[model samples]
Target chain A: MLSENSDKIQLFKYLEGIFTELEQQKIALDKSAIVAFTDIKGNITYVNDKFCEISQYSREELLGQNHRIINSGYHEPKFFRNLWKTIARGNIWSDDIRNRAKDGSYYWVATTIVPYLDASGKPYQYVSIRFDITKQKNQELELVRRSKQLEDFCFIVSHNLRAPLSNLLLLTSMIQESDDSEEQKELIGRLVKPVHLLNETFNELVESLQIRQDTDIEKVNLSFKDCLENAMEALNVAVLYPDIEVHHDFNEVPDLKYPKKYLDSIFQNLLSNAIKYQSPKRKLQIRIKSYLREGSTWLEFADNGLGINMKVQGHKLFGLRKTFHDNPDAKGFGLFITKSQIEAVGGMIYAESTQGRGTTFFIKFNAK
Target chain B: MPNDPMKTIDTLYLIDDDDTYQFIVQRTLNSLNLVNSIKLFSNGKAAIDFLEATLHDIEQIPDVILLDLTMPIMDGWQFLEQYLRFRPRIGKKVVIFVVSSSIDPRDMQRAKSISEVTDYIIKPLTKSKLISMLHESLES
Candidate 1:
């Protein structure tokens, strides 16, 4: 009987030794806060290294304490009250929280609190896991501030510059009306050309500013055919040269919901440009067609004109104040504004050109 | 000036802010013997106020209104709005021409849209264009 009793005692000691080994392994493997306890008062009995690292307190300090040790003043009293209410009712709580460190600096953490029950199925201690995300939050805030500053700068430049520009244009008109001789008129025209150029430069600058600042998009139902008709009407006089021919194919798509005026402007600019930059050897042929693919509409304007060398001008095609063709009327603003207006309405435009062959503009629109 | 047969217009309204522009236009009209009387206003508002007060009086109404688009106190658009309101009271269809140097397509579109605007003449309004405008006005 004495030998049997000793054997039972040795077996119990062996089982206790196994449990100690398992606990040590858990502590080493876990990268999150781990706490162990019984059901009665819910006090922490065991705390891991990660728990001590996050809380900035030693295991001796946190072992007997509850979760109130790392409670940040950032959260309201109601926050903890609600948190305790959720966990006490046998529910797990997962949330993002701001916690205070030992040095009083605040840190953002994504936390998940899981409730553990004792052997009798009664509520016990909780285990929490957290990850730091303070850096990401700061970046988002900085981006918003910078965007607002850019918007303010755009508004001021647009308003102030336009006012003086309008006055200058008016003054030029009045001068033309005056009784100036032929010699004087010629000289005035020379002066006026430079003023016009200055105005064009200012317009390009404003357009660039607008492109950066104006991102809010409003959608409306618009007729594609009507937009084309309007653009043709506006450019009728300019494109009346005997060398230009415009063809349309709108059988596949009819109408689209977009910013109507912008669409017209884009069409007018591109169509006129095709005529303006036509090859001297051949007549201008602009073929406009639309097709549907993958639930989106694609419109193409293929032009037989002074084709661009992609190697040299590809990067600068849509850039502000960039002129490629030798056409005297080219202010280099048409494509820049066209692209901006297209993008502003949540559409996309791309160009494909081969030197001496022609250029084809592929515009994609999100179908309504 | 009133007895001069060549000066047919009763009152000439020059609604422009620029002193130099106003002086040049007034001098041109005087040289051409276009009007018996010339009334100059620095901006659209002063002209608007004068016209709105005298619109009911036939003797006070100007035969022509030369409007400039951009001004400080009131623009040509504001003046047009006021003129349109008092249009019927004046009895005659006052010849209104948009005299602007603005080559902006948007501005040109606006001028073309308005029925009251007889012509969308671009800047440096020449003597020949003004003469043609007068001839068309008389013929109509």
Candidate 2:
């Protein structure tokens, strides 16, 4: 009997050692700024090292004390009452709160509070975990301020630049259509070139602004053939080179309900790029093919052009103000804006290319 | 002004501050021979004054008013509002056409909704479009 009692004592000692190890782990986790609060009628009690640190009191000092002692007075009575009303009904309250530290300085915390119930199923205490988010909040505010400044700058640039551009367009139309002598017409044409360049620059600026503006995505049934025809119409002047050939095969594509302008611009930019960067050795051939794969519409723009060197330009290919080709007309904005416009309306763009062979752009539209 | 009632009925009244636009449009109208006479106004106020003063005296008001949506003092939208108030006073034969360079669809939709606006045309107005407008006016 004596031997059995001794064995039972040893087993109890081993269980106590395991319980203490778990308690230590729990305490270590709580040290990451978790606190528990109880009402005036004390129960299992409040817990947290952060609560002790902020209040300049240990867990022993905070256990029996009401939440009023640590209250920073930053929040009014109504704020606390509303918080209680929400939590007492077994709902969680999560928000950013400013609390006064023991040193009389204030700190911001993102807080989440959860309530605990006793044996009678009545509210006993609340466990609150808080993370320091003051630095992030400050950075966000600064970013907002800087963004507003940038938008203001863009507004000024747009107004100042567009007015002159409108006048230049009017002037060019007047000069071009005017019945002038050959000599006079040549002089006017010479003058029109710079104005055209200015107009193109302004157009690029406006395109960038439009990209920055909020994108409103609306889905409507649109025919692929109609969209292709519209793009061709818009690019009639640019695609006048007799050598270039564009072929479209839409056997698999059905009417899709997607953002129309985004798709239109995507096709326009890609087609224009194909025509703009044609290889000197070969005639430009652009083949557009569409197919449905796994409930998504996949369209490919395959071009026979001076293809991109993915080994070098891949890093900056879709980045703003990045130009890779030696083509004088390359603004480096086409693919960047095109990619953003596509993604803004919930589509993805990818490219496959070799240095001298050709390039193909694959775009996948989300299934309706 | 031309004396023939038929010719005068199809005349254009252009209101804009830009001298170049005025000159170009007048030249285009003459080349096309679409109208008898082209009345010009530098601003909305001048146009309004001309209409109000000659409301009863003039034998025929213009067939079409080519209005610029954006102007120095009074814009096309404001002109429409004020013109509508005086429209009943003027003859019902006149039609207001909003001519603007803005490609914004909202502006086009707004113009379409207005009772007084006959049509919204994007600039720079070509010779064929002007001829088409004359044809439309004759049919209407």
Candidate 3:
């Protein structure tokens, strides 16, 4: 109320101006932070407009709810236990927490939960001040994934490169230990084996490197049957196994918009592998089919040949220079490249097999 | 005790996919008179098959098993994992030495971590190095 005296009216206006300034500062602080207040039992008490905006919860909906309402379940139980312990002890707990919003999307928040104490020095309320850090957290996760891939790449390169080099060293050493001139000549002649392998390995590495770059994702609509026919013609499976009965059914999904090179390579590898590992005692049977499954088109190549023992070699099935049989003709580069090609086009490759029984390979292609 | 250490290891097993390694290493063993018998396998699968079948027979398992890391069918790591399961059933206290061309520290760490793996040797296992290894294991 303003007094009739001019001096009293001026003083009242001055006090009102100071209060308005303080209220403006409070609004600015609330806007900058996602603020919430919870009771000692962690029940939600008060939440600023910013908090409601970020969590997509209204004041009435969140008033009685606990912090668990927005819990993303991404963290371990021990994390929340430690956080509660610290805050319950009237201490500030600061951590990066991932919480879920009403729309089911997750966001990261760098938060500080400060406990407010009563006259008796016991925590009565906790004020959580949070700043969105989802962008930073995503960057950190991407960095970690890339570093892990780099490490795996280093491992593959080291293991594959060293195997051939070892042969070179051992081959020369063996020749050095020999005495007979004729035997020496034979041993020296055998040197071509390791040398040829080294050359093959480097060539495979170069090809795989090109695939890993994954810049050639140009696609054209192509028929599955035609690609298979082309690959079979190149491989000449009929000459290799005349009695090898082959079947194809691509009615459900006859064609794909995929990279021509990758499709041909995949077809060629699967066909040759089936023919190469054909059972010695029985006639080989091969069946190829394509169908739509789980929102993706899948190509299945099933062969009643010398099936791989998936139990033993499943993990390294797609690894570079990895073989699952004693076939001298097994170069182990085909599957590696096949997998790389499949994955490059947002697809995947896997196999199931039983030794001396049969092996089936599945290639998932994008439905588009 | 046998006066000659070479005779101590009456039989040895070499498991590797590389034919060149098998050839030269076999010759090196023969020239050095390292053992009276040497059984060879091209992959871990064959060696593991033998081990599983002969778990009850003490004479079947060789004194020294030189394992290669990279092989067809079953890799050395897969073999080691399977071996750990059947190790208690086997009668012999066989010593397994991992021989790999991989100079990667991860392989070295993996080899050292396995209780069944006695040692990890890099490729180019010379005759002299083999002889010295024979002496070390025999002495222990």
TM-score of each candidate structure, all chains considered together: 0.39, 0.41, 0.81
Docking class of 2: incorrect
Descending-lDDT candidate ranking: 3, 2, 1
Compared with the true structure, what per-residue lDDT tens digits does model 1 show for residues A1-368? 99999999999999999999998877664754433332334466666666567667788876777656667877899887887788777678778778776767766777666777778765676666566666776676688987864564354344334433443554566556657677346435534544554576576566655764656555577666777778878877445675567788888877776766577777888877787767887888889988887888888999988899988988667753322111334555678778878777667899999888799999987644
Query: Global lDDT of each model?
Result: 0.69, 0.71, 0.83
lDDT (Cα, tens digit) per residue for candidate 3, span A1-368: 34458878788899999999999987887989999999998899999998899899899999989889999999999999999999999899999999999999999999999999999989999999999999999999999998886677666666666766776777776677778889889888878876777777677778877887866678899999999889978987668667888899999999989889889989988888788878998898899999998778999999998887787878767775533223544656778889988888888889999999989999887645
**Which regions of candidate 2 deviate over 4 angstroms?**
A1-368, B1-13, B35-37, B49-63, B80-123, B128-140
Residue B93's lDDT within candidate 3 is: 65
Model 2 chain A: weakest 10-residue lDDT segment is: A320-329
**Candidate 1 regions with alpha-carbon error over 4 angstroms:** A1-186, A200-220, A237-239, A322-328, B1-140
- On a 0 to 1 DockQ scale, where is model 2? 0.02
Interface RMSD of each: 12.7, 12.2, 2.9
| Minimal lDDT window, size 10, model 1 chain A | A320-329
Docking quality class, candidate 3: acceptable
DockQ for every model comes to 0.01, 0.02, 0.48
The digit string of per-residue lDDT tens for model 2 on B20-58 reads 557657866787676776889877888888878777854
Give me the TM-scores of chain B across the candidates.
0.89, 0.88, 0.91
Please tell me what DockQ candidate 1 reaches: 0.01
In angstroms, give how far residue B121 of model 3 lies from its true place. 1.9
Task: List residue ranges in candidate 3 displaced over 4 A.
Answer: A1-22, A53-59, A176-179, A212-223, A250-258, A272-325, A328-336, A343-368, B1-8, B48-61, B72-93, B103-107
The best candidate by TM-score is 3
